[model samples]
Target: MTGLPMEFRAEGLPDRVTIYEVGPRDGLQNEKTVVPVETKALLVSRLAAAGLTAVESTSFVHPTWVPQLADAEDLLTRLDRAPGVRYPVLVPNERGLDRAMAHGVTEIAIFGSATETFARRNLNRSLDASIEMFTPVVTRATEAGIRVRAYLSMCFGDPWEGPVPVEQVVRTGVRLLDLGCAELSLGDTIGAGTPGHVTTLLTGFAAAGVGPERLAVHFHDTYGQALVNTLAALRAGVTVVDASAGGIGGCPYARSATGNLATEDLVWMLNGLGIATGVDLGALVTTSVWLAGELGRPSPSRVVQALSKEQEPDHAQA
Candidate 1:
């Protein structure tokens, strides 16, 4: 919440909007190099320290699909769990859920794309079939008293099948809701959505009785509209947002996709708007820089890049 006044408050907005930091898992999943387990653990710990209420710590998917997350178990075991912060892992199936459960994971996220083409391409299942699979996972998780977050991919448009209809998105979301998902994250998988699309889709969902509290937004920056879209969601009464540190992450199935919305940028916008996300931008920058060092690459977060340059000492001083 850096850059925000102590008494800062957005009029007519909720007391705070919960930011779901997906850096540890979504951000690292698409990396070519394998981030050390220590680095991943440190990222999760740092995110919690920065005051993110919900940090997506890791994914329990097969290592073959996302090699960068091969050390998920190790990373999860090492993150320092804060008392009030939640750590959720993405689990694709029962086996993944089992692995996550064994580590005492209290929250898990299941994903299903809105379009059949994207589903078959990304998840290897039909849209209906994928939604059905989550039913059992949701049932078991509920019985175990674990909260589940379900992701609906390509809610606006898919690379394979363009322009996903509002009806399809609503159907998939309703299915996840029926399966007992605590939240349905609507993802613009390829960054093809605009503010208008967000309004339309959110309105459709609201009409279907899936109110703002039960939804989250996951947007990419490919078209440079993530922030604006986020603002739209906020106006529509949506509270939770999914972002990646340094804007890391991409859809592996969509090779041309850009990074997920940068967490620093999102924090900057929220702080300026007097919306409490509870994230410390300076600490977020440090963590992103650490991650960049681990990957041997520069961060994509504009705020991080600018702030890093500002913080560097003058060459003459050296």
Candidate 2:
């Protein structure tokens, strides 16, 4: 591990940041190639070994919508759930939640959109109707002693709707919270967010009584601003950030959107800033390299690339 610069050490950042690893679930869901259930289980184990306390294992959405994760039940059943580790899965509706419950799932996530077009296109319903749909799911899960994390996607910009208003994001987020979600993850699904936009939205969240403690920021690297936006969120007192190993997954609905913020990249920044994430940067880079090979591609993470290069034996010196 590297030491933090003196200047950054005094930046008043959180002493520890919670990295919610989404590699096995969100990261693999958009892959054109089919990933075996065993590989997904191994990915979850590797993430836990790398000190990721929270790993999203899979989603229970209908296979028709996300064929890649059709093996959600098999993957979850085969996962090696480590002590003190969480493997939350995405439950799209009542049916998904029931399937997750049948497998003894303790944590689950539900997703909504900040824009009407995205809501209709993604969930086949209007913004208000989608929230109503989630009400039963969230209520039932909470009653079952399951923790729920709600994701509000396209919080910054929508592919069809253009820029989304900050107020609308706040209002939707508040509604999700009211429906019994334990935490809300604001997503930059299109990666259209800048540091200024992040700051402004978080400010609105603060005014709406949604403090940083109950919020997580999920950003994509479509525009290469994910890390900058993450930094801005961190500085604003947000501690939980969502990332994918190897930068593998993207929104299948948003054609222009690319891979998510890489776990290795986020750890590099947090580690350098003296923020404890309990993750081993070298181990995480190695995981991404392995996963990239499985997907027959190179990792999109800049940190992973740099670290892999550094680890290569120097034939010139030899």
Candidate 3:
């Protein structure tokens, strides 16, 4: 596998899959303990050094809403931004966008929901109203020459609303794209998605004239189906995936949510399949292990756990 082209072609999959690292932002936001700003900055630097090209650095939400990321501006300012790496921050509304713009952010993300229940719970608005809220944010970001990525939550299934209709998801996603979002990240917020469900949703999007090139898949491993669903998306021609370091993230408002798909785990599978992600799995595992220490717990990522276990004997021998 060594020396294989970083952009090798794979049947039924893109030549490369862009792994959007969401660890510094999403992963840390939901932690019970507050991670120091210095540590968060170090994590972002380490991730970029490990060959992650696009990392979601932080969110610009109010401190009262997400106290964990209250230092978003400070963190961004402290980062030693790696050349060729893109750091996109999450902006919930126009106000968040204003804050991001002040820091000269070049890329940002806006979030919406496919189900009304989750929309109300997460964004404090109805489904339609949430889209209305993000329209101006997306518009302003685009006008400022910033690339905007939109995240549509609960695309697969909603805990309170049960199974979500595929049509509804497509409608919300299309609206975001129409509002000037460069890409849409369909989120399986509750991790209730299966391979079949993923295929169905992608197919629905296709029918709605939304191709995979403009879409990314974000999955959680609550039921251990994230990777499987990811495979289904790959088969459907999606080349972008959103994952977190150490698989440490969940929606604070969604009671049934769990940690996201680990970047190490996703890279391990992609490496085995000869897929190019430009990510160093061993380095990512090390980063996750260090982050787990910061959180005072073992990483939830299977790849990180197994790799750390494998290194124990070598350390003991030394």
Candidate 4:
């Protein structure tokens, strides 16, 4: 009960797993310093070269809210988009979707919280009202032939509401799926979840006829349990995971929440488990090192730190 109920091992597992790269969007969004537009584009291009199939390029939210991503339009417009990959942007409303469409976005993501308290605290609306507002956004995006992914935030727990109800999470997820969401990302916004909690939730979804294939896991590393929960999910048949590079971002309103699991850390685990991520770990580490330097802090990834130490020469030997 303290951690994973049982120690799980990933041996002879599937050769490949899909990683939804959210560095360019989620990682950079919470950066205190505003990353230059050119730098943002470079990050996306590098991620593409590193073999990520889905790169969340940016959020189309208002600049007044997230000034770090104020250049979303510019970055999207100037990207040297890679073939055979999808770049999706976070669109909170019709205006955000319109802006994304103008930039030639082929895929967009709409997000809502599972609990009314979380919705009101983060978006200033009730849970029912928030869903009502996004129905049209999803409808128009579908009509325009753009794939939409729905994000169900605080599925695990919330800062204001505390432990979110499974029924509430299911209700919201069903609505989004009914609205034609290609996939639903269940977010542990506060990083207060454990493997047992995750299994309970996934089991509930499965019993409700929602398989793991249609679901993605988005975990924060607030308590360093993201990877632990991920291992649990994979054993349960989930293949898609959302991670950020350098462990760089968290929700502004979710107190005490850290960033998403580091891409390098997740990749290391997946690769070790024989999961095919198609990502280059060396390149990912390099990118994490560069971004951590830019952020003026050491990376939050334990794997990166260990790797860095191993590569360093023992000057004390002299």
Candidate 5:
């Protein structure tokens, strides 16, 4: 059996948190080897079996952008929607949304940039033009009764722009929320944020009348600050966190960004806090261990590495 963390209830943290699993989509997006649609289907099934409710399944972006997820439609067809799980797909534009809608997707996520530099570099447009682009996408999705999530990358820092201002991020995020997005996920695309920076940013959002309930955080581990920053966000009442299995994936457009906070690692910390994540830690570790084998690398998650070590050697190798 995999090991578990000791329980210690933490005050001011949510009793239960929604772990937005990004392993299938984000984890494989940056993979050099395109995972077979069947393998991705199995990964999604395993994550659902491990109790992650909101799994980011795939993206409808053009194949030129994310070739690894080119078979998003096929993956969805194979899975046929896991029971008790919500599989959200990324839709970069109206065309992508059309593809997602064709596949009967009920939830979609749109990614944006907080910094002008990243906006220009990633979207090939100015920040304002990108917002203009998202307006129609969000409006159409919401009108169709599809839940839309907006992602504000470079919310913390950008490799080209350096540290992004808290005010700018809030303003950009508020604009996205105004476009009818149900939730705005702030991303430290370069992982350069500190805990104090995280607290101040959340405070900025609060002052602007955006509460933690409508917010989520996506952090990379470049500076090894993702976990601490997450703790800060949780203290600030942000309950929805985005993580990848086996600590895989980073911003494909941003070279400096590293792997996201690992799901097993986050679950271990939450388990110790006596917080209910509805995730079976052993099952998750086993899944990630199996995933590591498929990737031809060991899992980068410390929890997965440690627990895998304690398991029978014949099982998922540590």
Candidate 6:
């Protein structure tokens, strides 16, 4: 199959895709080492420069729980934000949203769970109670002219309950979107989804009158189906996909959850498909390699691992 690569546009896929970069927040959150605030700031800048429009900068979860992002305020303060880029942050509750508001945050995300077990385990509340909590958060954020995104975890499967129903996911997701969220990111928290499952779920959403334009898919690569499932999603008309640089983060609460669909891998596939992502693949690979050095682990991204080797001797090991 090859000399120099060629481009081919597949049928039924969006011509341009918006990558929701989650590496800075989700990727580093699970790391044992507390990445220096400066390093975090640099990572955000590099990702923006690499042309990701939406880079999730950090989370404002309570320090006692997610200690790694305790320096959220500092990270936000230090970032010299790139123009035309949106650096969104995760605000778990009203207090977190208050802190974000103080920092002049323009975009924020609130994550909820599709299953009752995950709602209790991850959010410390029942599914309905969590929605009760997000109601005011979304209301106030919208009133302040801020944009809010909702994350519905355990969309495909739950560690404790297992095999979540599509209708249940639809109901939970609609609740979040109904609360004034601009979009809803469906999370396969355990990476338990297949291509057929993806089609069925998107169908469920469509039946509920939630079109693909207002939906995003966030898949974990635990079962090696992330990319395939993503293809299924795109075919189902999803233009927004979530990925983390170097594939560094996983669900800290869900033991079996693994790294996200790596940004480099997603970019490579999207590039080969002739879809416009506005990302400089070479620059993104370089940034991810540098981040791997800071984390003291090699990237799980196949593209980064291959390209960095050809970049330079030091970069390959970085």
Q: Tens digit of lDDT per residue, candidate 2, span 1-318?
A: 242223256375798999999888888989998898888889899999999999999999999999999999998879888999998999989999989999999999999999999999999999999999999999999998999999999999998989899999999999999998899999999999999999999999999998999999999999899999999999999999999987888898899889999998888788778788999877888888998888889998888888898888999999
Residue runs of model 2 more than 4 Å from their true location after superposition: 1-7
Candidate 3, which segments miss by more than 4 Å at Cα? 1-10, 314-318
lDDT: which candidate is best? 6
lDDT of 1 at 251: 82
Q: Which has the higher lDDT value, candidate number 4 or candidate number 6?
A: 6
**Residue range 1-318, candidate 1, lDDT tens digits:** 233334455666665788899988898898888888987888888888888889998898898999989888888778889999999999999989999999999999998888889888878888888877788899999899999999988898987777889998998888889989899999999999999999999999999988999999999999999999998899899999999999999888887688999999888888777787778888888888888888899999988888788778889979
Q: Over 4 Å off in model 5, which ranges?
A: 313-318
Question: Per the 3 Å backbone cut-off, how many clashing residue pairs does candidate 5 have?
Answer: 0
Reference-based TM-score, model 1? 0.95
Q: For residues 85-202, what per-residue lDDT tens digits would candidate 4 score against the true structure?
A: 9999999889998898888899999889999888897778998888888988999999999999999999999887788988889888988888888999989999999999999889
C-alpha lDDT score of every prediction, in listed order? 0.88, 0.91, 0.91, 0.86, 0.93, 0.93
- The count of residue-pair clashes in candidate 4 stands at 3
Pick the winner on lDDT between candidates 3 and 6: 6
lDDT of 6 by residue, 1-318 (tens): 221136788999999999999998988888888999999999999999999999999999998888999999999999998899999999999999999999999999999999999889889999999999999999999999999999999999998898898999999999999999999999998899999999999999999999999999999999999999999999999999999998989988998999999999999899889999999988899999999998888999988888887655676466
- The C-alpha stretches of model 6 lying farther than 4 A from their native spots are 1-5, 312-318
**Candidates sorted on lDDT, descending:** 6, 5, 2, 3, 1, 4
* TM-scores, one per candidate: 0.95, 0.97, 0.95, 0.94, 0.97, 0.97
Worst 10 residues of 3 by lDDT: 1-10
lDDT of 2 at 117: 97
> Could you give me the TM-score of model 3 versus the true structure?
0.95
User: In candidate 6, where is summed lDDT lowest over 10 consecutive residues?
Assistant: 1-10
State residue 285's C-alpha deviation in candidate 4, in Å: 0.3
**Residue 14 error, candidate 4, Å:** 3.9
